[model samples]
Target: MSVALEVKNTYEDFILEKDILYFRVGEHGLVSFHGKNYHIKKRLNTEEIQKMTSDSSFFKVNTDCYVNTRKIQHIGDGKVYFEVRGSESKYTTITKLRQHRLKEIVLQQKGEA
Candidate 1:
């Protein structure tokens, strides 16, 4: 079973760490799960959310987005791919600076380190 990370939002619900694809900073933090986006309570930013979801599976992909590595279908050619609901796939390009870090994490996860 995936570990559950409780995040208090307007709905006051718990979100599974594995179900989270990414978190982005907007007016409030937006936590993406599958195809849905949840507004994280006003106080938390992507960095705080990262701390809350602290695990090897989560990493900051850019200045505004933090991605869950476990949710990644693949990462290459500067794109980070994620599996969503149906026929559609979601992808976000990583910054050149952070791309190398993400690749390291992916390799470490695969026990290739």
Candidate 2:
């Protein structure tokens, strides 16, 4: 479930609608889709983003990140991991503390299916 978001930087506002794999905590708030990360210029944070996108298939995997569960290839070691756009061996992770919630979300979705 790719989502379209409006994000702003120091200079401009940009539309970022992509097949977001995951968001990693970084210098600019969150790093995402195909390495196209952005800090929302005091517009939004991780929690806000989660709330905004949850019904569209985003989940707060941990404190430091939110992930599009549909893109998750694996979850482990307090992290949710997935493939990047053009990489085989390379993947990304977001910190996960109470990892069981991830399982529950998957299970719940599967039940729906």
Candidate 3:
């Protein structure tokens, strides 16, 4: 059976909400948004991003980026990687670890975790 899940949280006067997005990636890689690509100061590894994903305080969209899910627009996957859409970026791909964590988060959001 298919279940639907929603993630919601409030931080520093900002309200974040995330809907479940599904996709599959073959190997892990980095992704940058259209405008923010230049400002990527540092990239978080899969393990670190995974931890962030479970915090309930952060949102995990793709391997390369962890948005508050509240900021997600959509999720898609190509032959090599998965992409997540935000307010500006057309797509963002996540890492392998975050991929697994995303599944767990979705399940948790559905109350199945």
Candidate 4:
């Protein structure tokens, strides 16, 4: 299978996509990617990072990335590009099985699903 560039491990151990909205996956957590290259660093996991969202804006876009739908610029190339709050060029890929559900969630957030 051909993985998308957005899914590449650019941040070593950190999985970064959203600049503001995020979630936890394992022993560590994602803070937020920033600056020109959208480089991200590791952060101590916090309760806030794992908080459950009951709204349409926040959902899991990938295995370790939960995003606010409003932060997305577009979805294509098996990935989700973001017009995020901090970073300039960070994106994430949804699992193939979840892609359709992601579309439904995105559209539902806009009342178009």
Candidate 5:
């Protein structure tokens, strides 16, 4: 589960508003978002991650990292599966559980399931 909140930023007497969003998990995980590395204190199962990435707003750039799909540059698959765009490099390979979940997500996203 995750909590969604609103955020307000002020700079030079100017105020900017944004959403304060976070994902919840039992253990912490590593992620890279918008060129910055983030330590996700919440741990989530592969199925949850897959569901999250199914949304257009999110993308599974790697097995351990789910990025915003809008940020993806390109996707490649082979012995070394990866996604690279600009300064971002994401790995898509993972354990069997994650791999299976990823495949399900992909199929769901493509409307094949």
Candidate 6:
């Protein structure tokens, strides 16, 4: 079985770990998956989400956004991009300080084979 986040939204109910593209802070919290965004109703914050997805595919890219490195298409111009199947592409910013770390993580994954 695939691991999934317990946060519930008004749509499909829950988000699967592998399908998550990223999570960002909003009125509450927002989780992006498969080209769609889900508003988190629970009181959980970005920090809490980070802890739950740690050592997994998810990496906290900045203060309020956590990205699934496996879903990343490319990183450039201070932005991290992802392909959204049938929808338009999406991107989120990566902090200058954290860019190196993100690169290391992506490169490390590539070398694992």
Ranking under lDDT, best-scoring first?
Answer: 6, 1, 4, 2, 3, 5
CA RMSD of each candidate after superposition: 7.1, 8.4, 13.1, 12.8, 10.7, 6.9
Lowest summed lDDT across 10 adjacent residues in model 6 is found at: 32-41
TM-scores, each model vs. reference? 0.61, 0.49, 0.32, 0.53, 0.30, 0.64
- What lDDT does the true structure give each of the candidates? 0.66, 0.54, 0.40, 0.57, 0.38, 0.68
Pairs in steric clash, model 2: none
Candidate 4: residue 61 lDDT (0-100): 65
- Candidate 6: tens digits of C-alpha lDDT, residues 1-60: 999887754356554465566776445555443334433434466787556557477787
Give candidate 5's error at residue 20 in angstroms: 16
Quote the positional error of residue 42 for candidate 6 in Å: 5.0
Predict model 4's lDDT versus the native: 0.57
Name the best candidate (by lDDT).
Answer: 6
Over 1-113, each residue of candidate 1 has an lDDT whose tens digit, in order, gives 89999665534454546446766655566544332344343456778666655655667777667777776777878878886555566777788788888888887777853
Model 5: residues with Cα > 4 Å off, grouped in runs: 1-31, 34-64, 67-92
Question: In candidate 5, what are the lDDT values of residues 1-113, reduced to their tens digit?
Answer: 99988663222222111111222223343322222233223344677555655655553434344433333333335211334444455434344444555555555656742
Expressed as tens digits, the lDDT of each residue in 1-113 for candidate 2 is 99989654423433333444555445554444332342333345778555545645767655555566666666666655565454553344544445677767867777787
lDDT of 6 at 112: 90
**Candidate 5: 10-residue stretch with minimal lDDT:** 13-22
Rank the models by TM-score, top first. Answer: 6, 1, 4, 2, 3, 5
Best by TM-score: 6
Q: Per model, how many backbone clashes are there?
A: 0, 0, 5, 0, 2, 0
